[model samples]
Target: MFSADALIQTSGNIVGGTAGAFLGGYFAIKVMRTQIEFQRKQNQQEKEEQYEKTYWLMKLVFEGLGSSIDDFQKTMNKPDIDDKKDYPYLIGLLKGTLSVSKEKKELINDNYIPKDIYREYLAGITLFNSCEFIIERWYQTLHLDNFKISTDNYQFKDLIVYGNGMRHIFNEIESIKPIKKKVTTTGGGAK
Candidate 1:
């Protein structure tokens, strides 16, 4: 038969061991949950940052292209300039210089832009470049004595196509543009 004191000591040890195990498990779970919550918050913050970067990039491209398009249209609408006498000057004015930075280009090139916007961005670039080519070809006609640049040139057909295509792309970009958040304030008085 076991001694009474030894049996009580053994019982105390068993209870202490079980309680220790439960407490340790509880703490382990709490730590895991805390770590998981922290990771989730970190991931959400990163996504928000990326969204801001993409929005800014798109805005920059949109404004730049808008300005370039306006300039191109204004230069093309000039009716007073003599085509034959100011052909070179007119050619310079018609140059489609839609300059984009390498980083901005990489957004589309490297597939950073969303899949939906990707096709429109590429189409915009192609139309812009095509317009440039058409202007260059028209300018080269100066070498030919009979060829005179009038309101109607062979490139006009292609230019019209480019113009329509650009309009579509611009609409797409405008649709995706982020809405600016407005801040509201209550009445304030300094005095």
Candidate 2:
């Protein structure tokens, strides 16, 4: 019952509607992909910033605590000195420098840390914590437990041992490029 012109117009309307829907869907998908990529880039930048920040913090800590006694030794020109006789005194003298501020604690946060590199940060911080622990224990042994100056390098050696390993691991982590973690599966799903 429709005229030829009316039928053509109806067909054109249907085609136009379908094409518009398809194009709309396509653009929506493209926008979503762009947003996702943008988010990923933003996240990557944040992670890099966090990595640099934490790295510098640990580096300062290492310089302050790791080499404090050694620096003193080297400065005092007593590399040949017996660690047993000197460790406690060194700890006592350096006790004032071994402190944690609120700002330092804020650097070791969970929010900005990437999931793959948590262990690396943890290892570095553990080294730092070990130094603090050793200093406190030595202080306590002298003041609280023994109530006398005990010259021993046991605590110092323990902290230094962990610190050496921590430095190695931290250096390795620093060398790693900030790319997606790749895993090679050798048939057992081990990454």
Candidate 3:
């Protein structure tokens, strides 16, 4: 049998314990939610940063390669140009500019890229690679003693045709706001 005073004291303790447990659980959940939200924001920030880095890299590559292509065409047309000197210089410039794109290519598949412009971005990359491929073939002939200026201007012609599209895509990408990708969905469902 319990004394009346003891019963009241036990009741009070049980109530206190229940309230303490509830409060502790509630605060614990609040802290967890806060941490999760913070993590999400941090992830978003990282994605935006990656997007910016990729954008700048692409910009430099497009401009650099485009300029090199133009110079190659002009140099090729020069009647008095030295094949050994000018051709190698233009090839070196193109390859050097392309190395930047090659090194950071992993960023192309990142989630930060804008969905609408992804195809164009890929097209630009393809054009770049095509140009590099042609240049590599030409570079292979450089060591030959019989090296002569070949009149196969078709590849450079194709590059000229695509250069306009690349410039347009660059402008469109530049106009995009940072982290605009978050508002869009990566999966297929509804708009």
Candidate 4:
């Protein structure tokens, strides 16, 4: 038979072991939860950064195109109206502008762009096309739609179009727009 003191000692040891096990398990769970939360936050931050970079890249492209259009308009407005026969010179200027824009587009596609963002790039192209279309329309209205001469209104319209598209993209990425909640109608009764 065990002595009373021995029995008390054994009981104390068992109690201590149970308490230690509980604390160890609790700490392990807490640490795991903390690690998971950290990872989630890190992922969110990375996504936001990627979005910002892509937005800025597209914005740069828009600005560049806007500036080129402005320059073209200025060139067209030169006082030397008799020199309007300079087709080769105008073609060279147009080609140079296109080349620069293409290079910028390639740069954006190469850097700070992921395969998943290809759709966004395609949308950017669509936005560019819309800007060009609007400019063409304005040109047509002013009878300056010919490829030879650029008009002030057309250039301004181009810039405005580009700016609007940039704003739209930014708004989309930032989620500034309110989410529409679906209303469920029960028996045509207003709730």
Candidate 5:
């Protein structure tokens, strides 16, 4: 038979063991939670940086393309449109606008755009289907074949699609308005 003191000591040892097990389990869970939170924060930061990079690249491409288009349009609207001799000048202007940098030219010849701006422009042209044919020809001239749309930047993709769609619809409506105006003017002239 066990003495009272021995029984008490055994009970004390069992209680101490239970408490240690509980504390150990609790601390393990706490450490795991902290690690998970850290990982999540790191992933979020990476995604934000990727988005910023993509946005800036798209902005550069848009600026370059917009400047070129404005220049071309201005040249086309000149009063010398009837002069057949001016055709070569127009072609020269287009060639100059479309010409890439030496580094980009080399990359194109090797079948790529070494910079993100050209990649975004290629992707944007595809997403904006209304301008695809013209942009496709331009892309082909550059020999840039690896243009892939990044789904990592879903918000940017959505913005591009929405903005392009709105612009296209607006253009169609504006075009119809001009046609209506012309018809009304002709009818009034006949009257």
Candidate 6:
């Protein structure tokens, strides 16, 4: 039979080892959760910034286009060009600035620009460097050729007024980003 003193010591050691393991496991989980939370917050912030940047740039482009379209409509309605008439300033502005605002230009230029035209496509390239701002040439049948023409004024106006639904979409996106992220992260929700 085992001695009573030996049994007491063994029971004490078992309890101590279990308590140590439990504390270690709890601390490790706490540290892991803290790191995960930090990562989640950082990612959420980046997503918000990206959404805002895209929203603002698109809004500016739409505004510029809408302004130009308005001027075009007014000019087209006029019977003849008057020597005294001061041309719409935006006509030159779009031509000069590619319809991009100063802030948008700074954002676009932050990405590295490569001189070589023929370079392999790389993932994670900024939207500015990757996307092309192109206006397909639309020939105005009667007198104008090689000019970009927008057919609908109302749609263009809407685009300027509302950056093509980005505002609403981003609002919903932001709501999801901030609230109940843990539930969403758990992968239980339907897409």
Among the numbered candidates, top TM-score falls to: 3
Give model 3's TM-score versus the native structure: 0.68
**Any idea what lDDT model 4 has?**
0.59
Put down candidate 4 lDDT per residue, 1-191, tens digits, no spaces: 99999999999999999999999999999999999999999986775566565556665666556555556556656777433365345445544554565566665533545555455566667776665565444444433435443345555556555646644553553343222343786676558
**Residues 1-191 of candidate 2: C-alpha lDDT, one tens digit per residue:** 88999999999999999999999999999999999999999987787777666656655565555556455444334545544556566655657556642246456555665667677767766776776776677677764433433223465456657656555665666666343444676766548
How do the residues 38-126 of candidate 5 rate in per-residue lDDT, one tens digit apiece?
99999866654554444433333334444444554555456656334444454445445345321222232212222423444444444
Residue pairs with backbone atoms closer than 3 Å in model 4 (clashes) = none
The deviation in Å at residue 55 for candidate 4 is 2.8
What are the per-residue Cα lDDT tens digits for candidate 1 across 29-102?
Answer: 99999999999999866654665576566555544544554555566568776656776665555553433522
lDDT assessment of candidate 3 = 0.70
| Cα TM-score per model | 0.61, 0.67, 0.68, 0.54, 0.50, 0.48
Model 6 poorest ten-residue lDDT run:
116-125
For candidate 6, the C-alpha RMSD (Å) to the true structure equals 11.9
Candidate 6 regions with alpha-carbon error over 4 angstroms:
80-94, 97-191
lDDT of 6 by residue, 37-125 (tens): 99999987775565455545544543444454445456644666442332323234334444254345446332332222112112112
**Model 4 poorest 10 in a row by lDDT:** 173-182
lDDT of 2 at 181: 48
Query: Where in model 5 is the C-alpha error above 4 Å?
Result: 80-123, 127-191
In model 1, how large is the Cα lDDT of residue 63?
Answer: 46
**Candidate 4 ranges beyond 4 A from true positions:** 1-10, 79-94, 106-123, 129-147, 150-191
**Model 4 residue 165 distance off true place after TM-score fit, in angstroms:** 5.6
Better of 3 and 6 by lDDT: 3
Better candidate number, 4 or 6, judged by TM-score: 4
